[model samples]
Structure formats: C-alpha cells, structure tokens
Target: MSHYPVHTMATAPEASQPSLHALQSAFGFIPNIAGAMATSPVLSSSLVGLFGNVHGGSFTEPQIQVLLLTNAVTNEAEWAVAFHTTLALQQGLTPADVDAIRSARLPNDPAFAALSRLARTLIEKRGRLDVTDSAAFLQAGFTEEDLLEVIAVTAASTITNYTANVTKPPLEPAFRDHAWHPA
Candidate 1:
C-alpha cells in the first residue's frame, strides 16, 4: 500500500482524473480503492468504464447491489464488502438479506437467492457457468438479457475486488459502519 501511491484528483494521472472525480461525486469522496487504483491510469479507467457499462445494463439498482455484494463476499474483498453492504441497504435490500450474504448464506427471498447463488457460482466457477447454473437463474424469472448482464456486473466487481485486494485500501469512514470480513 505504501508503494501504491493513493492518489487524489490532483495527484492522479490525467487518464484517471475523470473516473476519480466521478467516484468522488457519486460517493462524495474518493474511496481509497479508487485512489490506489489511480496508480495505474489504464486500469483505473477500465474499471470506471466497466462500471458505467454494468450500471447501464439491464439490472435494477437492487439487483446490481446484490451482484456486487455477492461478488465482494465471494472474493473475500473486505473493502468492497463494506462498501457494497451500505449500497445494498440503500437500494432497498433488507438487513436480513444483507446479513445472510455477509455471512456467506443465501438470502431468504427466492429471487434474490437465485441472484446470489448465480453470482457466487459465476465467480467460483470463473465464469464457466454450466447450463444448470444458467437454467437456475432463468427459473428464477430472470431473462437471458439478465443472464448476460450478470456477467457484466461480475466483471465490474472483479475489477474492484482485485484492485482492493492488491492495493489493500483502507475503508472510507462512511462505509466503515458496514465493514465486513470474509468468514
């Protein structure tokens, strides 16, 4: 982390500035994840681009949060787990569901359970989802489009998850209340 050079908008490379500033505006601060990510402008920009694509995809905000939280927990990314925990609640997920995901359990709700299971499987299987995995997601009422969108969300989360692990960014204060550790 000392070697990673956590950057501010002012200190970040020009390629990274827009992404950093956007994250700052979205969360009202540049998360340490983005700061450390700024150390490599190309990678940072790639994350921002992937983020935009995922957010613009077919999933609703709540679904997106579910995917993110699932990825965070699956990957054991403490920083992302904390950040996505807050976001998941804000997106109208119940505390119980969030807790279930945080604890590495499936949510009680059927659809969300399907989503969490699908996301976890996608990651655990390294995106080589078998037909049964996709079938289960479809059985839960998700569309083929939704299935593809899940891949986008997974990719986006993978960027954040990997970046946080590598940079070991300290959690931002606002998200610390929901801080998590992989069980």
Candidate 2:
C-alpha cells in the first residue's frame, strides 16, 4: 500500500490548498495524484505553476496531451497513463492515435507522430538526443522552439508520472474507462 496520503482541499496543508483549488478549478475536481502530491507544499505548487505554463505554451492542448500520454506510457506510470489517456481523447485525439500511443507506437498524423516519437525518445534516452533525433522532429515540421517546448511539456508530465509511480494514487472513476497497464 502507498504510504502517501491522498489529500483533499480540507485535509491538505494550508500552503497546498491553493494549488489543490487551482487543480479543482481546472479539472472540476482535484486529481487523486495531485491530492497525494499535496503532502508536499513545494511539489504541489511547482506542479500547478509548471502545469499552467506548459498548457499555455506553444503547443495546442491536443498536442500537449499527446506529449503527456507518450511520457506516461514511457515512464510506465499507470495512473498517469489513465489520466493522460482521458485528456488526450477529450482533446480530440483519434481513438486510433490514442491506442497507438498506449501501444508504444506513433500516431497517424505527422505532427502527432513526431511528438509521440520525440517524447518516447526523450524518456527512453533520458534526454540524450543526438542530431539525428532532433533532425527528425524538425523535418516533421516542428520548429526548434517547438522542440524545446516539447521538453517543457515533458518536464511537466515527468513530475506527475514520477509522483504517480511513487504515491500510487487510486484512479478516479472519471478516468476508469481509460485505465492502462504497462506491458
């Protein structure tokens, strides 16, 4: 069993409540993972801040979801896989594309394929991308700026992915249909 407490707004430390509130406002409820993360004020706050920046950054919401889902799959974080899978579909990613990401394959769309490949490569290689690795992304029509933004999105998902692995938060019902297991 996980030692971490899945905090709620009322149960979280005072410093963490605001972050939880922000999550609530954004998602209509605080995710169980974020609730567990609330045990640490710093982590919860940092996640919320970085989340805003990443979601508001260069990529569209669907693109961001692609990176997040890819990262979760690569990291083998089950909770994150389910969470991101739900968000990716809600953001209008095709069912085939979502299935492709879950299966460790690229999507059909060129830009999404580039994003999934780059995210998986980033995690699998632990951020060590060579010229060829980056050239492929650029060749797929993403700019250098967009490439860096992928790092930012990856960073954001890494926080959640790692946290979910450690905290082992129970998946909420809303994401139940999309639940994933690492193969």
The best candidate in terms of lDDT: 2
Q: Give the C-alpha miss distance for residue 177 in model 2, angstroms.
A: 1.2
Tell me the tens digit of each residue's lDDT in model 1 across 39-86.
888888898889888888878888889889999999999999999999
User: Against the correct fold, how does model 2 do in TM-score?
Assistant: 0.98
Which sections of candidate 2 miss by over 4 Å?
A: none
Candidate 2 Cα RMSD after full superposition onto the native fold (Å): 0.7
How does each model score on TM-score?
0.95, 0.98
lDDT of 2 by residue, 31-75 (tens): 999999999999999999999999789899999999999999999
The root-mean-square deviation over C-alpha atoms between each candidate and the true structure, in angstroms, is 1.2, 0.7
Q: What is the lDDT of residue 86 in candidate 1?
A: 96
